[model samples]
Target: MAKRFQIFLIVCLSISTVTFMLLWQGQKNNKDDIRALAQASAADACIQFTEYQTNGCESSYWYGVAAFRSFQQAYHSLTEGTNKAANYTFCNEVYGCLVLSPEISQSNISEIIETMSILSSDVEDENGYIRMSELRNSLTR
Candidate 1:
């Protein structure tokens, strides 16, 4: 009976420790993924801005869409786990943020990206969905 009790305690402690570590790592990864998203979008903004400068609004819009598609394609490559739906939702939120800003110019992309970085760092739920109910701007999409 004594040995059985000890075994049960050890098992419980081990599970608790592992669960804590996993949650901690998940939180850390959330931040890291958001940072990466900001960086990639910033790079895309530069090219898209160049397109806007050289060609026109239509050209820049298409270029921006393409670059954003690339970002979406690579986004999944950055993360892995049971939280894929959450990640997708988070990504869509950030994508909406990136596109529909009031000031969507070359000079403003950095500010937008920075805002995203700041917001994403703290927007995740315990389940990893970035359900930012209090966005600074109302998201129509």
Candidate 2:
């Protein structure tokens, strides 16, 4: 009976240790995945916005809306846990543009293109990843 109990305890501890290690690694990988998703989403937004510019809003209204929605989602995810005035301002501005008529929206194509250009650069830069890592570290601490 004593020998069986010892074996059981050893197996339980080994299993628990392995489980803990896997969970830790999975969490790290998840963070990396989300970061990549944010980057990719931003890039897609830029591409779609450029397409909207090329095709014009009269014909590509839906494309512009879709791109704007994607940009909003990606921006929100990337900026989570950080409070910055510029973030809110940019989001609100884009939201306003999204709600306008197609003719009005066409007039704002330049603004949308510029915004996407800036966002693309930001997401492509290491600073975006660093910011997310710092935020994660601060929370863990």
Candidate 3:
């Protein structure tokens, strides 16, 4: 009877340990996913700014198409039970850039630059696409 009790306890302890590890790992992965979404969205802004500088408005427009998709991903990420307004701000600004991407031109680049600056300001998650400064710098150049 003593031996049986010890075996059952050990088995229960092992299962509990495994479950705990899986839960911890899931939490870590969620954080990584959040970071990745922000980074990709930031990249969308950078690409739009760069393309506008190099290719002109038309180039920006095409890239904006892609950026829109990227922003959507970022937006979806932000809304994933996180419901952060700052995060939505970041996504919306990028989405704005994408919306005008098709008509991108010297005339509008300046305005887009302004929007990017506002978006790059601060975020609920520090790991987000903190690259707005770089994007803004490119536009200013």
Cα lDDT for residue 56, model 3? Answer: 68
Residues 1-141 of candidate 3: C-alpha lDDT, one tens digit per residue: 999999999999999999999999888556556545655654566567667766766666566446545755655665666546555665555555446443432445555544443443432344343443333333334
Per-residue accuracy of model 1 over 1-141 as CA lDDT, tens digit each: 999999999999999999999999888666566546744653574567456555657667556645654554455554445456556555566556546653443334443334334433433323223332222233433
Candidate numbers sorted by TM-score from highest down: 2, 3, 1
**Which pairs clash inside model 3?**
57-104, 61-101, 61-102
Report each candidate's C-alpha RMSD, comma-separated, in the order given: 9.7, 8.9, 7.0
Q: Comparing 2 and 3 by TM-score, which wins? A: 2
**Model 3 global lDDT (CA atoms, 0 to 1):** 0.55
Top model number, lDDT: 2
Better of 2 and 3 by lDDT: 2
Candidate 2, residue 58: Cα displacement in angstroms equals 3.4
RMSD in angstroms between candidate 3 and the native structure over all alpha carbons: 7.0
* Model 3, TM vs. native: 0.49
TM-score (all chains, Cα) for each model:
0.37, 0.57, 0.49
List candidate 1 segments past 4 Å from native: 1-42, 49-56, 82-85, 93-137
Per-residue error (Å), model 1, residue 43: 1.0
For each candidate, the alpha-carbon lDDT, in order, equals 0.52, 0.58, 0.55
